[model samples]
Target: MRTSNYDKFPFVPVAKAEACQTGWAAIGAALRAALPAHATPGQPLVLAVECYPGTALGPLRQALTEALHPALCLVADDLYRAPADLDALVAGPLTDDPVFGRLNGLTVRDFLDPQKMQVAQATLAAATGQLVLVLGTGATLVCPSPTVLVYADLARWEIQLRQRRGDIANLGSDNFAEKASLKYKRAYFVDWRAADRLKKQTLPRADFLLDTNDPAAPKLIAGADLRAALAATVRRPFRVVPFFDPGPWGGQWMREHLDLPDGPPNYAWGFDCVLEENSLLLGFGAARVEIPSLDLVFAHPRELLGEAVHGRFGTEFPIRFDFLDTVGGGNLSLQVHPLTEYAFDKFGLSYTQDESYYMLDAAPGATVYLGLKEGAKLPAMLADLQRAQDDPAAPFLAAEYINEFPAHRHDHFLIPAGTIHCSGAGGMVLEISATPYIFTFKLWDWARLGLDGQPRPIHLAHGAANIQPDRTTAWVQQHLVNQVQEVARGEGWREERTGLHEREFIETRRHWFTGPVPHDTLGGVQVLNLVQGAEAVVESPTGAFEPYVVHYAETFIVPAAVGAYTIRPHGPAVGTECATMKAYVRT
Candidate 1:
């Protein structure tokens, strides 16, 4: 319980097996010794890091630190720890933290580095019979060859992270590492064509190997644990190592190495991407691929399409669930998602409207601009946008452009095509919706960009054409807000028309853990994405979880068309509330 200046971490502040220490380097040293030795030539001891509180390290952090203490035992040469203590960890010690308290019996080496870890990788590659797991950030690689690195930016990270406010002290580098480490994971793999290029210089790439088809895909706890599970599941020896990038190595390299036409590749559409495992994209795009295996993803729509598509497209595309953390916030443009006619007529964009906001957490009183204010004038609204450019920030679109709504926790706002809105600051929102192809307008914005230092672009032409003509501003106020009611338990789900698409969109509503949930995919798949809870679990044949599985704050895609799924909630079991929306799945 000893305390000190570093209140951020080492929360316990316990004297080292030796003496008091300072600095991350010293911490790293203590950590290094705790791990097992390198296996043969390429394999190294693996470890998994559990998160904790106490920014400066103290009681809170120590309370949260996982398995590291036991690993320190394994490094007795450096830690001066008792051998028995190490044994204690092998039995159970990683579960000190409430969120990750279940994994106490894992070994020390298994604490920090897991499968794909350089150490674990080298070791597993050697055993011929056993599998090794390694976990790491992007910086661990020191390559010396010519290899192809595929960097895919999936998940609506930029969109959700936009709500972080000034909490992003480190800008792009620091912020990216934190959020990226938390949700955006990495996976390392060896590509023969890519091997030569990366022989000497290790390049960054996306983790795209986790097969949605793998029965164990949904069972994976998080991106960090993905390797250990994959290794344990696979029977054959896999030379391919999927690495997780917890640092700037992959992001920086991805920006620099990508084969952009003129400028760097612009991360256009939103999709989910993990830096662990063997693959990154749920679909395919500008990223590089190893062989014909991933090529077949396109022909299959049921694999990619979600609740949104089946309701319209008559099919699904091979796709995984998309999770987002809107750290920063902005007013979504005030506009209507045109019916299929407006989509094909106005701008030729495919699906419009159809957006869901699953708010995980937020500061008190922070509001989001949802559809037009109750009973407002459409003529005046259009007049305002036309005149919005009159202000100095005129060109600054996407700002307080849409109708502003005060948003609090569990507040679900459905953005049907034609609804004018914007996500204001002061919240971390989980944005889920149709296949992200229908953002039709951008009228105002104070003009902002990601930590990378760039101003967000606006599409006034596209946005303007989508505004509902007879805007009474009362559509949502009258129908949407009024529809809000106590979640009826036993329904297993809820339904309602959000906007113009009749039944095009239906957000899911939970009365907070009434019973087991149904799992199936009509449009694509029912995505049980984690909007708030950590350790959220869905019982599907391919993916499995511990009894009373934990629903850590991470969104997961429950592939559409599957049989009924039993959804279980963890983490205080929604003691407070749950995100609201009618899940728009195909009938």
Candidate 2:
């Protein structure tokens, strides 16, 4: 099932009524304001309405057409390629093995035929009406020219829900990843990717943006003041929509604490910080709507990421934070991510996951396997991995090759890409790293079956190609483990450097205090976690906005526009201290 945490407090930011007004009433008001004072009957008016898959376009089309009489409603699905051609495209070859298997081949171009689309456009253009409503996926792409371009969007999770509920026209009977009995969820992947790509291509050029995330209370972004809305949004502290997924090595920490969906299989990973697959929720009264976090990067890079950083990385949000929990669960698969150049050549990614594990909590004897033993032979290790892969009964000599160190609360273990590592049982780890995360080349998985009751895919060849031989036990100990050192201090607070891995462009620092910590964004974006104590308030020096309250274990961002702010620890015992982990690009 799809998941999101924007509905919960402590994760949602303060909302301004001028920028975010909730409910279907908001959409109705915006639409009325945007419309012309009078409609000329029999005049040609093009309204290109683009939507994600699983949207009930028929109802929307009917509603709009009735509202504007003398209108012609043209459904794009009626113009799609024949059923046989769609089936062939779904089974066609993909650019690579999808990060999420079976969902790779789904794309906008796959389900469409260029010649037929052009013909449909011409046919629609020739027809006469007061309003020509072109509604469906790729509507803007084929409308030739539209008077008003409407990007009607729904969150991926909501779309998935509708698909499961048999509400989507084509995807109703098709199987998704969870319902796949024999093969992969090929059908769902194709539809999902097609909708996703269409939204990406159309949203930027949309004259009016609409949110159907809550079908009961649709919202609209229509006005000459759209830029101001975006600016107002970027100035506030916010969290990306959080989601959870289950895996073979999954734990119960997130499910137990975050009010996540209790499941047949426990939640293994929580996407607390991610951009490519995450979204930002814009809150209005009793209504929350979201846009992909990439929209902020694309539209207002300078405000969110400062001039120096926006110049260096462009629109890319380089820092990522996620959770790796093995508490009351099994060990993670021993893995290494692709090196920088390797990732670009093979996976088309500009970055790699050069990560660090900041332990939140750990049980007795918890361990983390990092780096290789000093004299470990690469060829012998490769042979053992091959044997394990070829014969499931073969032994995995994990201890001989990997150095397992005892883990503790507040410990930070640096793991640059190409280093073999995994978190063992009984620890809750906050994985802070560079943005690219899906390229993990897993070498071993402890011979465990995945949630789908199948063996997870192994990547020995990729791992061997990318593993760095110099990251030995001695090197890891000297350069990676618990390398906390004092950097600066003030009246009642101090700063310490915790993670500054040479391979990563992002660095992490810990601020511990009993009172206020005077700080500035320093011309760059900062992501922070209140890892200790109950609560804290971050306020601007000018008092231009409300004090942003951050709760324990919750993450929030401070945009560069916010210049300077002070962090005041709250709800801690009189003389006790609290701590926060702040991460940002080195620039």
Candidate 3:
């Protein structure tokens, strides 16, 4: 089942894993072959579904009313929005300005009102032919016209791991600043840009799509295999799966390098290759599934980011990687980000966070603040970061307009957009840029708190309207440090060109190796990582296929239809050498 040259792009080829080993009887036989046989049983079979918010929805409404047996279901959270107007919009008034903190959260048009959208459109227009509704967040923006809609996605890292195992309680107030400020007010102000404008106005007038991101295999993707699995999931070689957060400079290097699942407290950021907050997975047979890596960049952004990065960041998955971990813990905020027409005229981001970091490990005297010193002054570093965020014991800021440096293991830095950076304490970094990773803006944090003990949110006037002040200290030691060169070598490999960043578009190179290298994906998408290896692999040149491997600091990804590959390392002896780094897109 390996054929996939993107059938000139349209999508829908997914079903392998021995025809997706039956799950919910393949979404009840894909809702009985996309319904409509003289609309049986009475006439109205609505079936909306839509979900997210601890969705068990009473065992998905008793498994779609016992797999569609004379159905009825209903319950859009008993027509929500009322629990005293969702507790006055979750205890209201959140305005530290940035346009009321990007118009803060709670939506789906404030969770379905208009008398719960006229009692869910008069219970899907006075149902008769098995109407199994059951929606939740903004009940599919006021339900009704749905002979099959089903969305049911779930991933904000599995709804913050089932809201930290309380098994999800209506996404809010599970502490951590009432669930990370209502998950940064519903992903930067109201549910994923209002579900990408209600999925470009309801997925081209929906009919049947249901993925339910692996509720034990709830797939259903219709028509031309959901457009050839969204144009061969953006050209293949996938990864996503990473997710870890905790902060205030959290550490213990991903709690001793990832095997995850132990209550947080440390793990600061690891959305490794943050494709809109990671997910992917999809195996099928022995059951796998997952989804959201912005669902293959909102269903094939020109086949998973290619048409010149989907015509310059439209479906926006312009590189990202992640992992900050101040090992054992502390330092990171003091940020900046914005720029690029000020993150698309202030936060409507179409591209901006130019990041870099790299490093990978570093401890004794780790340092790394960066850029700003030789005659630094941006209004005395914005009056010493507004007198240390209004006197939380002011002392911290005067380290003479920042600059620092030192960090070791591989050391890379770069940062670009507005320069001023962070890292410090021990280290680990990685970062890799420009996917607008939470538009940083920070502006100092050593006066610490966050991990919900409070005092965090700084964005000092959006980092003084995006800092840079000519990125001082000899413009960050001649352009953000480690500007290596070399490029191509061969015979036991060489590579080089480590992160140049003239305002990054993601370049980097690194390599080093000892035996194999070859590489290609020149059309685009690359990402790699193994920052000094223990293993490698990759493959493609006729060795029929199946290779991949990777490891040590692991990151992965190649896709641009893989083209030519081969990395091959794995050591314990045999000519040991390895290194890796890669990144891509710059061309």
Candidate 4:
């Protein structure tokens, strides 16, 4: 593979005056200086440090205590209900299922004990002539209106890494030894939902925004500066920081092509534009402060995702672009997503995951399993899947029941909800889909152990309920595979409509150009990936925003506020054919 030129740590420069402070001492000093302005004479000053679920509160409280020498320091965890009681409260949302759980509408206050909160309020009312510090996930519940409020945030990806290391537990429970998958499911269903609700209410009013992703090196920025950075971001094309993880069916493609580190066994998944887990870097002078990308969605949904999309999704980013690599590895497990009504009834999701696989790179003889065979019977196929899961020695015989199609470079396979599909070995796929990504129901694995040495979970019952038996080989071939047609052309550029199927709400288009290609967001956000070519540059047509450069396999977003922009081949690909596949919500 050619030498990788991927920009791993992309950041947008903020004003020099908005410099970020590094280290705990500096952060504490800044907060100390700001305390005088908000403090009342002859009264105790309360500093509330409201944290997201995965933040490391121990070190934070310790560092701040030594720096400010607070007379009373309160931990929110001490005010929460006992572990068993908290679990019982959230058991309805965190279902018994291993991988799937219902999205709950619980807020942070629901997790706190009323009696403890009442006592804490009484204590805060009595403290005088001293500095009082309250910190933790539900710290705001104890001290609602503190003299100074600091919101400590960590990205979901960083939280997952911490969970894998057994460094933290779920929000209200102390299950440090629990399986990482179960912990993730609990956080996804219960903790994140509640935390996000609190974050939406408090982030804008926070006096300071704390970056707690790094344990030893914490960064702090003024809340106004952070808000200004986000406002500046929506006027231009930007890329969120990407993260990669290894899996059982991972491959060597990303490690070799993307210049990834060699420490992991293999790279299986690359999250390019999953805003929920990614981070946005804001550069202040030489320092970079990282915050959750979802903050942008919460702060300015209407400007980032247009009026219609905001009306439909309401602060939730609906599109996701990620990579699935199987080159020089094993095949992905056969899986299907739930239908819209099924998703809402069972999982409390407003929409289902409707996705498409665009083959970024495929070795010769690469194939993808899609749809059922022409003569396949639903009962027989389901029985076979059950046998495979029941008896490890019995193989599912995937090729016999599923239709396998040749996967070539740039081939698009539309996978609306309920369509059984998987990418076989020897292919690199860019999966463009809806944001509800973790609802997949696996039907059959290849009887291999996971990276943790346990058998992968299979959801035969859920898969059976959602599978579309009518999507047979002929139907898939006619309507799903390579459904590309020319839409428009100019002197040096042409655009083609790529298939996402009529059932899907995402519309995709492929633009092949050797010169500048014009694009309009059409009153909604647009996401694009440079599928073919080495490099390209995106610029504003009216020079309203700074030019942005992207490399091959890199995904970027243009907010709805950026009405008109142009992209052209740059650097090494200036004279060669460069292609970008763009996806937008269908109006």
Candidate 5:
């Protein structure tokens, strides 16, 4: 790799501790501090040991060391382990220090084989139910045995129902892909209501308009189509906070991108896909922000994202939330996204680039390309990149970037405007961003090809110009929060105000009243939904709190825009979907 005026070594340029959360954050901070200023087989991003949660760790770390990076292996926990095989890391390095003890009077390499990897996984997955491992590093531990269930791309939702007895179905197969070595686990997607209690609702006028590019196209922007698209729902008095399976894609995703020396379908950790908004379209201010599904809003990840559009709106549509389950670790460019000014000046675009990450998994030693490789000389760095474009034996800037980040798990970096960064491969990371599409400026790539069978294009120059050349680290340290609101809480039963959420259209909270309330009291229609273990009765602004869970806990769009109806939770009850939005707030 050649570049003009680049600096090297003396890593610890900035500390990320201020933005950290728990002890893991501290450990994350420490590990980042010790990373080598440059990466080689010998000196890399990972410099110290990191103890992850619940991992038998020692053996896993040894295996990872054999397969991935020894710099990242955690030695805090122990199992009878094999000798560290530098052969896998560096093919011909002579013995320096014996990292692990010998066994059977021979090197542990003589004893360990590929079969042992499978046995270790089976033991871990079974013992550690609800989790699995990725091939090399990290674990997809939350969702287990989730076989293949493909969703038609761009359709908002897909539903499969079984109305009669013995109406059987399956969500994923029993066999796994990749190695084609692991057998599949059988499971079906079904609702758990008794036959007698299950009401045969007409699936509620559901429809989907396939819109991938723009969000404001009348079909997706608002009106009947929007209401109809939201037909998929978890019913009243439900259990387990009904989750979206995101099936098949999980297994297939792991196999393709994560296949490595470790093996596939290794269930590790999972971060919930949070947030719902037209974030991809970065400019022109999105029309309506869907508030009903604001349950997806992980939090106000940033301080500024068009504050005008965030508060009360007397006109226009409501605030909305959107979701994306990305594959091939993109947002992958370690480029600084152009700011509103840069884009407007250059690309005639507008927006800011600030996104929060909810890390689903991080294979061991996955360090993020957080900053420059220390003491980086600016002029030399620029010249070398230019030279690469003209030379053959030289690596491109993007190639150098891939050589940089080894991003780990549960890591949240505040990607403010002008930060050059990227998430590495493996794991599902949920990106919550400002409601614009054009926040990113591509800097580097691992030279990964797209579905188009070509290396994805990069914008290193644009990204370079926008880079915020500052020394800072950690999420919490960068952004300060004055008040942290507990959204909602309860185990068996719940009934209370669900904190607060305000953006243009409506201010929402859990509204429950036992006795009678006047009609058109609040002066808007409210949509009340029953989520779990709760029975609610609504006296139609003019009527009484009805006696059923059918229309009771179900979502009933209050037609009157200026009325208050009485609400009461019966029998150890709680309501999850009990809030309203603008078009919804006035019901």
Candidate 6:
């Protein structure tokens, strides 16, 4: 096995920073220093500690109250609508479905009770000569104009971990004992959407950006410094912090290859470039501040995504690169993504997940289930799936109806929306696709239970509505499997166009080289993974940015503003062949 060079906590260095305070003592002192100016003659100084949905409020409230010795501290949870009322308010968006829900147009203000907000405001108004801190998820809604606004940020991945640990609950809900998957579904469809909307509105005006991912250790940076760091990052190639998780079908590849710690049964998913659920770290001297990677997309969409992509998808990062490792494990659930019209009509999604499985490493006899077998009927397959789900003793004979293709290293299988597909066991797949990743409708799960010991949720009705009967063996063989064509070649490198199918908006390119290969973003963002060799260094043609080194299986992003860069073998892979698979939105 190769020595692991995978950087788990990659951080971008901030060029200029006034200060990065660590822990509550330093942060509170800094806030206290800034408080004298905002203090009034009669009313108390109102400090709003606005938080993302999953921030640890106990430590935050305790630490701040101890440090500031506030005359009165109000938690936003106290001002929110009652639990039943809040549930009813979000029930429309968070449907009864266990996994899928409709995207709603609710904002953080909708969760706050106006009468309670007025009461809090009146209390703050009647306060005397001391600090009055307002804290919690919707703290800003209660005190819009505060003496100091500190936006406490937490990454979505950390939030998921907390959810699984039962350390935190969903926004305005006391269902900590509920299943993590159900909590995640609610957060995805309701909590996060509302929190993110508030975050976008409050970040620009925030005086301090708090890194609250860690309960014991908190890092604080000036809001301007955080914004500047994000702006600077767009001009250079960088990576978000990758997080891994185990599943029922997880494998040992990541634990062995990525130098992961000994925990969890196995590593099933590696989120390398899913900005919505990843965190971006910024370096301030010896300290690191963690914030949601989506902050960058929201803060500088045009600069990071270019005019065309930003205009087409708004502030969303349209592409994602992640890993599905099933080596020495079991098969993934048979699934299909919804068609665009079906996605919009049913789930309120503007787009669907059109993805491809690029084999990073495949053991002998590894296979990928793609599309359908010739003469396979949807009704028959659905019936079989329903029967298997109904009675676990009778397994669904998947091979009879699904096309299983032999998978090898570097094999690219395109799966457009409505194409039923899954990665079989014994392969490490680099899944490159559109960013609407959670819209998958699982048709079958091999009649196995989830890690939670419950039957995994199936969407047969949703899947039956979207699966394309025409994507049979013949069509898939001609269009999807390993569709590589030589696009260009240089002295020691060659470029190939890999298929994402004509129906998909994302285009993929593969380059194999023992020498430097030039690349440009073509006025849009690009996501690339080093699929071969040990390591490579990405450099600028005009010294616009410093050289960035990436290890094998590491996915990095080059923003549209970067313009041009070159990748060449570095370190142990100097003379060895190296290959990179890059994906970008087709313009």
Clashes of each: 158, 1, 12, 0, 81, 0
- Tens digit of per-residue lDDT, candidate 4, span 1-587: 45799888888887683368899889888999999899987667999999999899889989999999998999998888899998999898878888888987898898899999899888888897678999999888788888999999999999998898999999889999998898899998889999999999899999999999888889999999899999999989999999999999999999899999989899999999999889999888888888999999999998999999999999999999999999988899999999999999999999999999999999888899999999999999999999999998899999889999999999999999999999999999999999998999999889998999999889999999999999999999999999999999998999999978999999999999999999999889999999999999999979999889999999999999999999999999989999999999998
TM-score of each: 0.45, 0.86, 0.39, 0.99, 0.34, 0.98
> Each candidate's lDDT (Cα)?
0.34, 0.73, 0.67, 0.93, 0.30, 0.92
Cα lDDT of model 1 by residue, 196-225, tens digit = 122112211222121112211111112222
Q: Which tens-of-lDDT digit does each residue in 1-587 have in candidate 3?
A: 23211111111234566534246766776676566642446657666666655556666666666777645556666765565565457444334443223434345566555775686677666766554555655456655466667666666676656555545454332333335355454444555655555554555445545556456657655434444555655554545667667777888766665556558778888777777777665553454555566766766666555667667767767887878888788888777777888777654555677878888888888888888888877987798788878887775564688888898988898888887878888998888887756667777788868765877667788778888698888868887888888868879888889775767778888888778888887666778777775667777787634665656776877766566788878644237887888787875
List candidate 4 segments past 4 Å from native.
41-43
Instruction: Give one digit per residue, the lDDT tens place, for model 6 in 122-145.
Output: 888788776899999888888888
Q: Is candidate 3 or candidate 5 better by TM-score?
A: 3
lDDT, candidate 3, residue 572? 48
lDDT of 2 at 207: 71
Q: How well does model 3 score by local distance difference test?
A: 0.67
**Lowest summed lDDT window (length 10), candidate 3:** 3-12
Better of 3 and 4 by lDDT: 4
Error of 6 at 141 (Å): 1.6
C-alpha lDDT (0 to 100) for residue 190 of candidate 3: 52
Candidate 1 clash total? 158
Order candidates by lDDT, high to low: 4, 6, 2, 3, 1, 5
Prediction RMSDs, each to the true structure: 18.6, 4.5, 17.2, 1.1, 26.5, 1.4
Best by TM-score: 4
Give stretches of model 5 more than 4 Å off. Answer: 1-331, 348-350, 389-392, 396-409, 472-587
Q: Write down the worst ten-residue block by lDDT for model 1.
A: 5-14
Best by lDDT: 4
Q: After superposition, how far is residue 580 of candidate 4 from its true place, in Å?
A: 0.4
Ranking by TM-score, best first?
4, 6, 2, 1, 3, 5
Candidate 6 global TM-score: 0.98
Mark the regions of model 2 whose C-alpha exceeds 4 Å error after superposition.
1-34, 37-43, 53-70, 77-93, 96-112, 156-207, 223-227, 572-575
Between candidates 1 and 3, name the one with more favorable TM-score.
Answer: 1
Error of 2 at 173 (Å): 14
lDDT of 2 by residue, 157-181 (tens): 4554555555554432233333331
